[model samples]
Target: MPFVICLLFSWFLLPIDSAPAVASDPLLICWNNQVKPLQNRFVQLSYQEQRNELEHSAEPWQQTPYQASGTIWVNATNFRQIDTLRNTTRNRTSFTKTQADTQTLLVKHGDDKLTSVSRAMLDEHPLTAARYSPIRLIEYAYQHHLRPDSASSTNQATCYRTTINQTVISLFIRRADGLLDRATLLAPDDMLGDVLTTLTYQDYAAVGPSQQPTRVIVDKVNGKVRDQVRLTQSIVTDQAPTLLDTPADYRLDMTPTPVATARSEKYSDHVYFVTLPHTDDRVMLVEFTDFVLVAEAPLNSENGELIIQQAHQLIPDKPIRYFVFGHHHPHYLGGVRPFVHKGATILCSPGNDDYVTYLVQAPHRLKPDSLAMAPKPLKLEAVGARKTITDGQFSMDIYHIGSQSAHTSDYLIYYFPSEQLLFQDDLVWIPKTGKPTRISTRQTGLYRAIQQLGIPVRTVIQSWPVADMGVKTEIPFAELAASVDSK
Candidate 1:
């Protein structure tokens, strides 16, 4: 009688195809079933790829997208063996690996021996090689707080959703098949409200008792496909992988260092030019009767604070009332928040008000900044075609260099009519001593704008200067035109 009862109980407990699904922790289910099974296989993969060329400016005139072919080798325990990519354009090649038995990241270019990242900085920095690994991907998801938002079953697959807050990462996993289908990362930016990066994994193939995606697509938030990788071959090897070893001659420095001081000079009675060392980027400060006006908040908060500190020392009684952004580029706009924290009104091109507003108000809890701590409402002003500011004795003009310019559509350049001085941003990047290697279309446009405006320009102060170039402090307009003509 006991044996009969035991058999009947076991029969009822066995899972059925049509039965209601038992609740399962998605991350754990994927890790245990999918990632663990691939732990001991040594894998090799080759793929072709195309990616957008990374640029510093908001918009670049002639930058082109690039395509490449690469190979990746990995050990099953989430260790990168080797990854090499060869660009088709110039036949340039680069590869990355990690030290054996160490978490240190290493990289090498064509004909160059492997150079490892500083071990001191290794722990704090995230390794790119590990992020996409089958095991590491699961580990990363587990480390973050994961909530099972939903699950659904269809076509021999079951997908589960999970999210990470800071970068707004959304993960979709097919738990039944033990595969990650897609991940979306949304990063709020100063120019774009939300920049999306989407990764899709498809065409799964079996290799040595493990399944791996044979093709992956990466897309930008702008609906442009940024990169694609398609697998050519996969191999499971038995011998110990040798790709992680590095040559002794290669070197890498990982120590974080202090930023250098900016060089400052008084261009006019109240107009000052400050050029940051190493970066060769300039910030212009104008002392009005009651307050100060800063042009071009380039780089980050550290750079912004340095500029502000100098402004305070020079004009102790006044606050920075306005911070005029040169354009909408991320590199130049990073310092706007620091000025906002100091109760300054952010001034930018007319259309950029919404983005700047969103920027100042975005939550920064994870990495709280000065703006986040103070929590003040942001003040903003917009500049149209031409705006002028005067304080009885001194007057300044801000002109909108229309979209016809090469670098950006909505750009602003500062002109000090009294001083006959002009502050130019991306339009006129000059070296310290010599002419530019080539005169860009933007530079020519700037010269035309000056002529069209009929403003007397004695000297042009460029925001970006090449470091170590032996040149004068300012470029004379006549000499600039001559150089362009020669080019």
Candidate 2:
């Protein structure tokens, strides 16, 4: 009776082992390939990636990838790569080099310190996961359950779902050949929830004693795809790759610090101009009877905040009533978010509603911007031909250029008829040195638009200044016209 009671007590006190056991054999079986099994071996893969033009703003674009080709040297847990990408819009090209050096999956981009691969890249690529190693997956399964994926129902493929580091990954294996067919990973990001990334392995060919996927497709964020492998050169050498090594001449360019001085220059008695350093983008402040109006909230949120802070310090009495946008390019429009958070009304051009809507809707939880922390209802007013705001003493006219450039489609120019001051963006890039001014096709169009508007202007306030060194404030209208008329 004593022995029976003790056995029952022990049984009640011990933890229940009710969870089903996951077999490592099945996972290893699924990870194998006949041509080339991906394991603890080093691989050098050269692939080409072509980008799709999709404007998603929450994720900042580092490099414009019209077309790029790079060679990757990777082992089980580490890799070094160099990607040469081209910016088709700017007609310029640049190179970005990255490498993983440590055991904790820390990667370094150029001269920067090592950062975790997961934190550095938006997409958790399969190549970075060591696809051939089932040991990691087995260990993960011990902590989390690995079960059959019911959604995958192909005649030749069997799918299994498992969670690794909070990311849900589904692996599809070919039943006949036991090769990795596809792996779909759903990673929940703070900014974008449940971001889907897929890797498809196809066209298996024998490289050495093992088989390798000659063609692989990596489906990235926002429907962008990196597919096709044209080059099939592989070597199983024991020598370390020099391409993986960081060059001695590599240097990271530091960004210019934004000066927080509330210094304001008088464009006129009622109008003030404040130029933010680094980019030399200026914000115009129009003082009215009841409230103040601001023009062109450009660059980023920090820039917008600095401008608004300066505006508040300068005026201190009137509330900022309207925030006007000059053009709808991502470069100039980033500052709109901060103004929106401040309860200012946004006045933009037609077709700009969609872009603004996207701006407010997209999640910024990754970094948690100023606007994201202090949320506000987005107030936007779309104008077509003209929109005017006045308090009898002072008035401002916003005019749509009705001209499209390779830069932007719908551009708006702000005009102060009373001051005879025309404020425009990217129409004419003023030469830093006043040596000789030659007008391009863009400048000619801008001059014609000003003529058509019948607005007499004495001075032109180009959004971008002349130079960082010797910055020129307002340009004489004659100098701008002479450049075109003289030619």
Candidate 3:
């Protein structure tokens, strides 16, 4: 889970007291003063919001700015939110909807398919919860008990601090009107180090019986603007009986099918391909005389644990000694922490030691995983232009797909000369139906690298997108060469 989502769920577990022990507590007094006016202002509040955000993607340092527009409907008991994001660069438009009550939460993504999970699930997986909105935050605090720990006065605002499950949440109220001016959360992030997220509310406008902020600016402690939201419209109306209920026509599933088992296919006596259930991600296992080497840890720690179990089942007794990273992307490296916990050496392309170290060492205290419970020092090794690992009986060579490629600079591929096989990630995508209509620069890069290195690669295996070209994981090298030569 992302740190922000985990932090939000941690807030749900806080013990809510009806009132402060001491009525004279200044922080409590301020909190009450701020929340009292909006207690019973409206039965149903709805608003259309436009969001501009700098979202973090595969590369933590490279933030992508996107624009999304959505509408939110909230009542005393239930709330619904819908957001549509149109990515011009990718020529794709995605839609997401989240509706929740005390009992259940229903989420719809892109299509009519809806997933319904119990509200309790949010405690562990908060990504299913509604997106962060100032209105939603105010509604939650007003309905539930917010215990303020301390209060400090700034020149322009009074800040009240609340600590829940070791996560610090501070609200800054304007001294003049007692309206909320800003909110800040201090938490630990695996990629950004310690993150201090601040949301500043501005341009208040009257809505029914209360005032709503027309503009909200989200910023990080690093002075980067993360998101800006504008309230395009707002209205209050009488509550309807089933406004937030799941639609009858929508197909709903109770819970996500658990990926408890992995499917493995043996390519050779010493080599196997393993794939997790319900995902297109895969990993390769190479067995040696004493130990095993696993390539690519996809998804999260749970998947990583499954990979470890599958390896033990396939090649029993020998411990997994080395784990090779396909790239620095989150989907590829998200499971690397589990390998560290298992005492395996992490092999990655050059210039990723600090990143791999951060993944293993960052604080997972909010929701402790295996590494957090039993900490381990990162055993990291960098693969330069080319590095080989062998035990005489079995050998695997790691090669860097040079920076000149259109893809990432740190991308690495594995090869076995004896078997004439090559393994890579994100370099080739064989369409389910087309025959080399056009070739991408990424494929050209891989072809050039193979030609320059003079390795005889008869077959290529991909570690991602599990199903393509008739459910087979291997693609002939001639097919790729033909595609690169076409057009």
lDDT per residue, candidate 3, 1-487, as tens digits? 1234454445535543445324554334444543344453332333334433334233434455556777765543455677777665565778887766555567778667566554344332221222333444444444444544332457777555554334456666676765778776665554333456677788877656556667777776434546667765666555433434566654434575665568998999789998875557778999999999999877567778889989999999999999998887755777787889999999988888877886677666555678878988889898999999999878889998755456777888899999999998777866756575557787888888999889999999887777643433568999888878885
lDDT tens digits, residue span 1-487, model 2:
0012223223233333324434443444543433124355556667665653434221233224476677766543456567776667667776766665433233444566544344333234333433322223333433344555444536777666654444556667677776667766655343332345666777776654455566666665533434333435654443346544444644333344456443578767788888765656777899988788888766567677888898888888788888887776544676777788888898878877876776665555323557778789999998788988889878888898755322445678888888788887667755657744445676778888888888999988777653553534467888778877877
lDDT of 3 at 244: 42
Write down the lDDT that model 1 would get: 0.64
Candidate 2 lDDT (Cα, 0 to 1): 0.61
Ten consecutive residues with minimal summed lDDT in candidate 3?
Answer: 123-132
lDDT tens string, model 1, 386-440? 9898788889999988664577867888898887888877666455655578777
lDDT over C-alpha atoms for residue 4 of model 1: 24
All models: lDDT?
A: 0.64, 0.61, 0.67
Sort by lDDT, best first: 3, 1, 2
Q: Say which prediction, candidate 1 or candidate 3, comes out ahead on lDDT.
A: 3
Look at candidate 1 and tell me the lDDT of residue 272: 83
Off by over 4 Å in 3: 1-16, 20-60, 69-133, 150-177, 181-198, 202-209, 219-225, 232-246, 249-252, 316-319, 402-405, 431-441, 468-471
